[model samples]
Target: MEQNKTLVTEFVLTGLTDLPGLQVPLFLVFLVIYLTTLVGNLGLIFLIWKDPHLHIPMYLFLGSLAFVDACSSTSVSPKMLMNFLSMNHLISLIECISQFYIFASSANTECFLLMVMAYDRYVAICNPLLYPVVMSNVFCTQLLGVSYIIGFLHPMMHVGLLFKLTFCKSNVIHYFYCEILQLFKISCTDPRVNMLLIFIFSVFIQSFTFMSIILSYSYVFFAILKKKSAKGRSKAFSTCSAHLLSVFLFYGTLFLMYVLPGSGPCENQDKMYSLFYTIIIPLLSLFIHSLRNKEVIGALRRIMKINSS
Candidate 1:
């Protein structure tokens, strides 16, 4: 047992591709995506901070989303870029575990945060009279704190169990980063406990959160229908349309990546799905909120006008 603990000090990360011709192109493409993710998310955070008019609960949640996206992208992209640029695509065992923990925690945090955002929309649209009271500053802060607490602690259990496993098998992980499933695949010991824990957490976290979002939207829809004036209905729908779109994109990719049964031997397809959720979704999220949101656009225009004048 002791010898097995010392057996593997590092692990090779098999990135998205091995083709010599595709390496540079892939690197350039992801570099551009990473940069966009940074600018978009950070830009949103800056706008939220600078514009006092935007200091509301919806924007507050959006800011948190942007912050999480930036952190999650940073957790993976730098090491991924290094692998793309170098012949040796190796990550130390400690580094791999650390990356896995951060990525998983951030992913979980985003899931809960989206649910919170949905609830915020629900209150704004369904119970306008109670919106301010329900989503007061203190309550919003508490929700955010809970999201991070659950996100960070849930993954700690997985990492603790992971460290107990002996890795006498191949050290080459079959993914771009140290994903939980890929790590489990490389474990020589029985992974039933880990798998069971994953199943339970997935049910408790993903299922519960997804269902809550659905319920919130359902109420929001009915409330929108109750609005008599067409302009009022339009105004209400506009507020939530962006959030609804974001929810679809985030949950859709997540479901495809995790819930769907894999089509036989299609490792690349799985990786592609994972890429959408990890890389593409964050980039899309920025545009979804900023482009569709009139307030965000107005705030940007105001900032630009002030700067130019």
Candidate 2:
């Protein structure tokens, strides 16, 4: 164990490229995407905070999701951006572990947050009269608090098991970041425990969250259909659509990346799928929520009009 400790002080990340030509282009592209992600998410958070009309449980959950997306992107993008410009993509052991923890926590938090949002929608649509009482500020705060607590705690288990493993083989990680799966691939120690934990945790988390979302939306759909007024049904559908889109994007990519067992070798495809959720999803979510959301757009316009005056 002592010998293993001295063997790996740092790790080399291959970082999404082997070609010199692709490095600059990838950097420029991701830099733009990263900047957009920051602006969109942070802007949404600010809008939610400043708009009195948005001071509801729904927007509060959206704000939390925005915060998680921004933090998740920050955890990976800056290092990835730097690696694109440098020939040697080296990361210290401590930094690698920290990145994995932050990324995993943010992701786990998002899953829970989305489930909360779906429930919020379910209550609002299916039990409109009781929505105000059930989704009160206290309840929302408790849900957010629980989401964050579970999110951070779940990843710690994986990281704890990971730290015990000794890496005596190669230090070169195949993927861009210090992903738990990729890290497992290079460990000289028995990774069976880590793999089992990942499978168990992933299945538990994904299944619970996914089922909750599905059930919530199912009730929401029936409620909407029961609405006598066409306009009321339309409004309800519009409101639910944004959350549905986000769920589809997040869970769809996640399922493809983690849940589905691969029939054959597809490491590169896995990397791309991971990148989509980690990097691309944050950027996309801002538009998904803001563009279709009448309240957010109205808030933006009001803010813009005030600035013009």
Candidate 3:
């Protein structure tokens, strides 16, 4: 493989804007998105930390999710925003690789983290008596640790797979960021194996995760109905509604973007879908989690009161 080493000193990113007029508008929109993502995720992290009442397995998971969302959005959005301002959105090869790696890792982490959260909810509602035992701090840490480890590990393989290919052709990527799909057409080497690997993994992992969550929720729903009191069932359902919504939004868009048999996203459409996951979804998670969460609201009020006093 070293014989074909082009040394790959630089890559040119296509970025989100080929149109001059759209640059400022896109920049402003992304700027607002970036700001909101930062504040919302950071606020969740702070609320989780400050509120003693929120010191549960669920909040811990929420805190981890917020952190991941913040990192994930920052990984691509800031660079995207900068692209709008500059004359050329060209990024060096190493920088592009770095961007791809970060984006891939953070995104994969979110998927695994969401799975863990589903399991957490399953244990809570399906077997309340054993929730603490099943989701112990030690087990929770181990699950989260596995998610982070897999994040980088899987992407590292993909990057290595990419490294084997040659790219003497145009370096300009079609997407805003250095996405794996954009690298496919540029590779001088046959990308059959890489493409197959991506497709297979996408199907296996997403299906497994989705089915697991659905089965868990199914059991949870049945269990809730068995509860004699309406109030008890309502509380149980309420506790999981936000998570269900988050799960749906994240997986639905991801499936649309990746799972279907297509050539992948076009330049503009790619940017729009990318925005859904990278910026909007992350910001919405904060709202989704906090909207009906009295614990989070109370904590916010406490912080306000303390600050005011």
Candidate 4:
């Protein structure tokens, strides 16, 4: 009915925490994380752009990853920070859905990007001879294009499905942002079809990307084991070490959240983990790839020297 539509035009976001005392402190903490995410990810992209030495497939992918991370953080963090200070956590239905779509698309896109990076690493380490020819500029551009396309397309399904359901059961979303599951939970209409479709698509996307990355890494490790020189093996290991760690964190958290059975956490715990991937993961990517990376460090020093002069 028109009454129902008007009744639920706006949804209340539960936000990260409900305690009044925790609000300001959480806001400050997330503010720092948000600011750091912007500075760090943007800084990495800048470093890659400025440093001629990093103009390769690996660095290009890393730069793109940085760009995606900046987008992911921006999509979630500003509103979260604002809600922390304000008593009203009201978000219009359209705004909420749009926010989820942006974040979800970015997330799915990052998964594809990670998969591409795995292939890039495998080519570099497992098939070094063909790496340059195969990962040429055109190919890299296409790979990025495919990743972004799939990422954007996959989430539109859930967004469309969202419009079909009526949310008269409750306008209060139990989690932060307009997560697909939370929206389904509050719908008065039977959400079984929506849930089933979402589950199927989610499984396919996560499994396809995660499995491919795993397979690529497996081959990379196998090839490393065959190296005659210990130094060569060590070098190969070092090359993919940052990437492996990033894959573990990103995929591990996601699997726990969506793929596993009977693994649901309480509302607060869910919020905490959701916060981790949305904001914390971006910051982690910068640290894992750049802060401890010798090449990135060297690149930074060079850029600093140039700027200082």
lDDT of each: 0.88, 0.90, 0.82, 0.86
Q: Give the winner by lDDT: 3 or 4.
A: 4
Task: Report the C-alpha lDDT of model 2 over 1-309, residue by residue, as the tens digit.
Answer: 555455676899998879988999999999999999999899999999998999999999999999999999999999999999987789988899999999999999999999999999999988989989999999999999999999999999998998898887889998899988888888988899888878878888999998999999999999999999999999889888878888999988787766663422688888888898899999888888776888999999998999999
Give per-residue CA lDDT, model 4, range 97-186, as digits (tens): 889899888999999999999999999988899999999999999999999999999889988988898777689987767777788778
TM-score on alpha carbons, each prediction? 0.95, 0.96, 0.92, 0.95
| Model 3: ten consecutive residues of lowest lDDT | 261-270
Q: Which residue pairs show backbone clashes in model 3?
A: 10-93, 11-93
Kindly report which residue stretches of model 4 are placed more than 4 angstroms away from their true locations once superposed. Answer: 1-6
True-structure Cα RMSD, model 1 = 1.8
* Full candidate order by lDDT, most accurate first: 2, 1, 4, 3
TM value for model 1: 0.95
Question: Model 1: residues >4 Å from true position, as ranges?
Answer: 1-6, 260-265
Q: For residue 192, give model 1's deviation from the true position in Å.
A: 1.3
Residue 182 of candidate 2: its Cα lDDT? 84
- Per-residue lDDT tens digits for candidate 3, residues 1-309, read 657656445666667658889999989988998898888889889888987888888889889889989988988988889888887777876787788788778878888888888888889888999998889989999998998998768889888888787786667688778877778878777898998888888777778888887888888888888999999898888877778899899888777666763545555676677768877898888788775787888888998999999
Clashes of each: 0, 0, 2, 0
User: What is the clash tally of candidate 1?
Assistant: 0
Off by over 4 Å in 3: 1-8, 261-267
